[model samples]
Target: MKVLVMKPQELHKLELLLPQDKIAKVIKKLGRQISEDYEDKDPILIGVLKGCVVFMADLVRSISVPIEMEFISASSYANGRTPEEKVDMSGGPEISIKGRHVLIVEGVVDSGRTVQTIIGQLRQKEPASIEIVTLLDKSKCRLVDIDIKYRGFDVGDDFVIGYGLDEAQKYRNLPFIGKVANE
Candidate 1:
């Protein structure tokens, strides 16, 4: 899909990576799969915030099972394209994760540092189980090994924006995902 953003020069610099319809289909499929898998488990859907907000919102609606939702803010992209070795995490879930099945939703997995840190921290809470679901996976850029149970797309090493992913905190509101030009 081609988007002709006549006004915004930044938008014009983007090339479509994944269209909205494809993303929606992936989300719906994932939601159904999660609902089926955790039908009786009553898992908690923990969204990695800022980026996961849009994906989480749509994902929960597609799910047909009774579930709880929470948010955690973690980041390693404060300075550059490549993630910092360390991650900063804040605003964890209010509810206890002890003995509960936890499903973490992330918008993108690049270096795996931030999510790895989050998993390590969540492990201290003694949750019954922990799984990760990500919208975009860039395995080529992974610095550390991590398992993503559910993945929407496995993209090459490109700076992607839109559909809750961003660069410098912009383009996240776009319904479709795009690869940033000259990145």
Candidate 2:
């Protein structure tokens, strides 16, 4: 068997899905909703890196309510695009979650196994509430049930890249989301 490597330039050949302007509009709206919901309570936004880095940054700035930010590295696709049986996680928030509202921000959600695991772990810390906010939702690929309180866009099962979502650790810096061609 031989391995086929994709050239860097080929990554640029993507079909545009979510443009930058539209993404910004949706994020602003989500910010308003989240601010209103957590106005009286202190909410901690836990970002799932490294995909959530870009989305989380913009989202935090858009919200009117005061918020704390934390990050954890978790992935079901540790070695490849396809998810594995178990999710690998590390670097949880140092801040105590007990009695505080928690928001898990994700760049995209598919099988939901990883998010479910994160929720279970946080629940053990006894947060006042736990909610999910994802930039993109691929409901068609969901293998487990997860409630998302805030969502920026609903997408199909297409493999997307850009705006923090990567293809082979590339195309993450693109400002817009695009579907991988021939994927």
Best by lDDT: 2
Least accurate 10 contiguous residues by lDDT in model 2: 1-10
Reference-based lDDT, each prediction: 0.88, 0.89
Per-residue accuracy of model 1 over 1-183 as CA lDDT, tens digit each:
555443346445678999999999999999998989899997999999889999999999999999999999999888466788879899887999999999999999999999999999999999999999998999999999899899999998998889888777777899999886672
Stretches of candidate 1 off by over 4 Å are 1-12
lDDT tens digits, residue span 57-96, model 2:
9999999999999999998886567777799999898999
Indicate the residue-level lDDT of 132 in model 1: 94
Report the error of model 1 at residue 33, Å. Answer: 1.0
> Distance (Å) between predicted and true CA of 60, model 2?
0.4
* Model 2 lDDT on a 0 to 1 scale: 0.89
Model 1 error, position 34 (Å):
0.5
